[model samples]
Target: MLLADSPPPELQTLTRGQYDLVEYALAGAGFALLAYALYSWTSRSEVGVRYRPAVMLGLCVGAVAALSYLLLFLRWGAGYDLTDAGYVPTDQARLALSPRYVDWSVTVPLLTAELLAVCSLAGARARKLRASTMTAAFLMILTGHLGAQVVGEGRDTTALVLWGLVSTAFYGYLYVALIGAVRSSIPTIGREAAVSLRNAAIVLLATFGVYPLVYAVPVFVDVTAAWLTAIQLAYSAADVLAKVGFGVLVHKVAKLRTAEDVAAGVDTHPEAVWVSNVEHSRAVLPPAQPPAMATSPTTPTA
Candidate 1:
C-alpha cells in the first residue's frame, strides 16, 4: 500500500511552513558540522602528539554526522510531495531515520573514544573503561532505533515505551561512565585543564540530554505537523551542539592539557603552533650570566 494510504506513525504530514523549517534546519546544521569538522582537522597539528587522538576522533565524529545530516536533507527533499493541504508522502515513503540511526551508532562510539583519549587512565583499566562505555553507547543507539522501528511498523506504544526505557538504561550507564571519567581526570591535570575538562563534560551531558527528550516526543504526542517540526528542529539543534560543539569543547580541553605539559617540559609539540611557541619561549629567557672567575685565574695557573 502507498504510504499516503496507510501512513506509518514515523511519517507525518507537514504544512509548508513546517516542512520548510525542518529542511532549512537540517541543511544549515549539515554545513555547520562540516565546517567544524574541517576546523578540527586543522587543529590536530596544533596540539601535542599525546592528545592528538582525541582531536582526531572529534574530527571523525563531525564528518560522519555532517554527511548524515546532508543525506537526511536530500531524503527529505525527495520523500514528500506538495499536496493541496501541505506536503504529504509520495507512493513509497520512509522517514529519514535510518541515516540518523546509522550516524548515531558510529558517532556515539567515537565520542566515547574521544573522551577516553583525554582521560588520564592507562593500561588495562583504561582499556576496560573504554570498552564498557563504547559498548553501552552503541547499545543505547541500537535500542533507540528499535523503538523508532516499532513506531514505523505499527503504532505500538507499548513496544516503543519498553524500548525507550531500555535505551534510557544504557544512556544512564554512559552518563555514569562519563562522570567517572571526568572526576578521575581532575586530579591528574592542572587546575585550568581540569576545569575545562569538567565543563566540557557538563556541556556534553546537557547537549546529549536533548536526544532522550526528542526520542520521547512521539511517545507523548501525536506526530502532527507542528510537533513533527518541533522534533526535527530539536534533533538538528542537538546534533550540531552534541557533535560539533562538544567536539570543539573536547579539543579545547585536550589543547589546554597539551599546553600545560609543554610548559612543564613533559611534552613537546613539533608541528604547527609549536614553531612559533618555541621562538616566543626563547625570546623570554633570561640572559646568560658572566663567568664568576676572570681570566686572571688562568694566568696564575700558567
Candidate 2:
C-alpha cells in the first residue's frame, strides 16, 4: 500500500473527539516540560554565549516537534468525523502548513543562527573548533528544515528528493559536530557528552516510538489502535519530561562547573578577577617616598 493510501494503523480508527483529548493532554504535558527546562537554564545566568544559544535552539526544535505532532494528529484530526468524512486532503494541508511547516522554518534556522552567532563569538576568542561547529550547525539546520517541508507538504516527488538531500546533510553535520565536541571535551568527555547526545536520543526515541502508529492504524483493531494512539501521546509527553529533566541536569552541571572553577581559584569572570587583582596589587604596593632635597647646601649656609 502507498504510504498515504491508508492511514497508519495506529491513527486510523480513533474518533475525532478522542484524538482531540489525546492531543490536548500531550501538548500540555510537552509544553510544560519544555518551559521548565527553559526556565531552569535562565535561572543559571552562567550560560556562555555559545551554549546558551545552542540550548535554546535545542529546546525550540524539541518543543516544536511536539507541538506539530499534537496539532497534526489531534486538533486538526478532530475536523474529520470518524463516522462521516475521515482525514482529508485539506486537513493534511492545514497540518502541513500551521505546525509542521512552521516548525521546519523556525526550528532549524533558529538553531543555525544561534550556532553561527556562538561560533563566531568563540572564534573571536580563538577557539579552533568554532568554524567547523558553525558550518555543521548551519548545514544541519538547513537540511532539517527541508525534510520538514517534504513531510508536511506531501508532494511526493519533490518532497522525497528534498528530504533525502537535507536529512543526509543534517545527519552528517550532527555526527561530525557532536563527535568533535566530545573529543575536544576530553578527560570528562563521556560525562559532558551526555548533555547533547542524551537530548538527541530522547528526540529520536520519541519520534519513532510515537509516530509510526498512524501507519499501523489501518491494519489494527480500532480499540487497540486507539489505545496505541493514547500510548503514543504518552510517549510524546515523555519527550517533554526528558527536556525538563535534561534542563535541570544542564543547570546543575553548569553550577558544578562554576563551583569547581571557584574552588580551584580559576576565575571565569574576567571583570571580577581584574578588579580583585587590581585591589590586591594596590594593597601589596608600598606607599611612595617623598623626593630627596639638596640638604648639603642649606647646612653650609647655616
TM-score of predicted structure 2: 0.52
Candidate 1 TM-score, true structure as reference: 0.85
Question: What Cα-based lDDT does every candidate model obtain?
Answer: 0.78, 0.44
Residue pairs whose backbone atoms clash in candidate 2: 8-214, 8-215, 8-217, 9-215, 9-216, 9-217, 9-218, 10-213, 10-216, 10-217
Per residue, candidate 1 scores C-alpha lDDT tens digits across 77-150 of 88888899888876434755567889999998888888888879889988998999899999998998887664
Instruction: Show how many residue pairs clash in every candidate, following the order shown.
Output: 0, 10
Instruction: Please report the candidate that would top TM-score against the real structure.
Output: 1
**lDDT for position 42 in model 1:** 79
**Tell me, what's the RMSD of every candidate?**
8.0, 10.3
What is candidate 2's lDDT per residue for 13-39, written digit by digit as tens?
555665567657656765675566466
